[model samples]
Target: MAKAFASQGDMTDKQISFTEVGRDLYAFTAEGDPNSGVIIGDDSVMVVEAQATPRLAQKVIDCIRQVTDKPITHLALTHYHAVRVLGASAYGAGQILMSDAARGMVAERGQEDWDSEFQRFPRLFQGHESIPGLTWPTTSFTGRMSVFLGNRRVDLMQLGRAHTAGDIVIHVPDENVMFTGDIVEYHSACYCGDGYFADWGGTLDAIKSYGVDAIAPGRGDALMGQDMVNTAIENTRDFVHSTYRPAARVAARGGTLKDAWDAVRAECDPKFADYAIYEHCLPFNVARAYDEARGIAHPRIWTAERDMQMWDDLQG
Candidate 1:
C-alpha cells in the first residue's frame, strides 16, 4: 500500500512540555511539533517561533502565563515558514521582527508556503480560519540586532543558512542560553525542503562556538547542560550530512530523482528512521539535495500543487 501523504495521518495530539532551560527562559515543545521559545525579561517577554495558528499559539500563551505575567512585547520569527509565522496575531505583540531575507520571502512566496504546509499536515493547522492573513514583520534586520527588555539583552543574529536562507538564532547573554530556531534540532528531522545543504554545517559550527550552557532547540526536548547541547548540535550536523551525501552521489552519477531518494534512504534510514518527522521530511530533503547537487543554488518555491505532484512522483 502507498504511504500516507506527509503527516496527514498523524492526528494524535502530542504531550506538551514547558521546560525552563535558563533562569527566565523556557522552551514550549510538543513531541516533535514546531517548538516555541520564551524569554522573560525584567518587565516584558519576547517569543520566538509562533505556532501554526491562533488556537495553537494560544497554547504557548497559556504556557507563558503559567510562568510569568510579563506582557509579551516582542515576537521574533526566525524564518518565513507558515507554521512559524502565521500565528502572529495571537501574541498581541507590538513589535514583530524578522531578518530582511525572511521578510522578503514572506512577500515573495509566503502564501504558497502557507497553502503547501496546510495541506501537508492538517492537524497542525487546527483553527486555520483564525489566521488573519500572511504574517509580516514590523521590523526587519540584517546581520544582527539586539533587544533590551528593561536591562536584559537578547541578541538575534543571522548566524548562517541552515533550515532556510533567513534563519536566525536568539542568544541570552546573561544566561548563556540560546534559542536556536530551526538552525538546530534535537532528535528531530531537519526539514530541508527549503534549506541550503552546503551551508548547514558551517551554521552549526557557528552555533557551537558559543559553547552555550543550554539551548531550546527548534524541536524535541529542551537541551540543558553543555554535554546535551553538544550532542544535539553534532547529531543535527550528522543528520544533515548523512542526508545530503548520498543524494549528491546519486546526482553526480546522473541518476533520477527516485534514484536519489533511494540512495538517501539507504544512508539515512539506519540512523534516523525513528526520529520525529523523519519519514515526512525524507522526500523533500532528497529533492532539495538532488537539486543543490545539480547546481541549483536556490530552492524552488513549494506550492500545494507541487507538494502533491512531488509526493506522487516519489512515492510511486
Candidate 2:
C-alpha cells in the first residue's frame, strides 16, 4: 500500500518517505497524515513530532536510519496534539521536549483529546495497540532553547501561539529550513479546534521571519523554495481566517450555532475547496470558534462520543 493524500479524502496507504530538504534536514511524511521531522547532527539526531504510535514512529526511525545511524537523542513535540505527540516513546529519546503551555494543556485536556482524535481519524492511528499512553516531554521550555548537536545548532522557539496555546517551530539556521508543527500547513487543512484564529496569521508571520527556504508543516507535502513558503503561510492564514472569523461573527450576531456553521461553510468552501481535510476540520472549528466568541478561554474537552454528536449536529 503506497501512501498518498487528497486535498480532501481518505489518506492513501503507503510506506511514507523521509525527504531531505537541506543538509541533514529531513522530513518524514506519512501520506497526508501528520508529518515528522528529523535533524541529523554531527553525532546524533533530533526527531520533531512523533507519529501516532511506536510502530508508526519506528517506521519513521527506519527512514532516519537510511540517512544516518545517529541515535535519536531527543524527541521534540511542537504541541500536545495527541495525533502528533503520542509516538514519543519509540524515539528512545532520553529527553523529550515541549513548551510550558503544551504541558499545561496535556494536564488539562490530554485524555479527552486522545479519545476525541482517535475516533475522529482512525486511519492515522494505525497501530493504536502500540501506544503506551500520552506522550510527555521531560524537558519543557518557556520561550526558546538552543541545542548544539556537536556544533550543528538548532534553535527551538515558541514564536507565538497559533495552532495551539503552545505551538513551537524548529529552525535550522544553516539550512534555512523550518519544521513548523501545524503552525503553517501547505495546501492541507489547518486543524484549528484548539487554535487561536486571529493569532494564527501572526504566528505564520513569525515563522516567515526565519526566511525559510523549506518548511515541513504538520500536514501536506513539504514546502520547497521561497515561493512555496509564502504560499504555505498565506494558505494557513486563509484557512484560519475563513473558518473562524465568519463563525465568530455569526455566533456574535445571535445566530444559531447551525447558522454559524453554515456561514463558515459558505465562506470557506468556495475559497478552500481545494485544501486537504477542509471538511474534516469544519465542525470542530465551528464548535471551538463559537465557544471563543462566547467568551470561552480554553477550548472545551472533546470526547469521542461528543465529537460524533457535534459533527452530527453540525452536519445535519
Number of the top candidate by lDDT?
Answer: 1
Q: How many steric overlaps are in each model, in order?
A: 0, 5
Off by over 4 Å in 1: 1-3
**What TM-score fits each model?**
0.99, 0.94
lDDT of 1 by residue, 7-122 (tens): 98889899999999998899999999999999999999999999999999999999999989999999999999999999889999999999999999999999999999998889
Extract clashing residue pairs from model 1. Answer: none
lDDT of 2 at 131: 90
lDDT of each: 0.94, 0.84
* CA lDDT, candidate 2, residue 122: 73
The pairs that clash in candidate 2 are: 2-13, 2-14, 3-13, 3-14, 7-276
- Report the CA-based lDDT of candidate 2 relative to the real structure: 0.84
Residue-level lDDT tens digits of model 2 in 157-220 = 9998788999899999999999999988877788788888767778888888788899988988
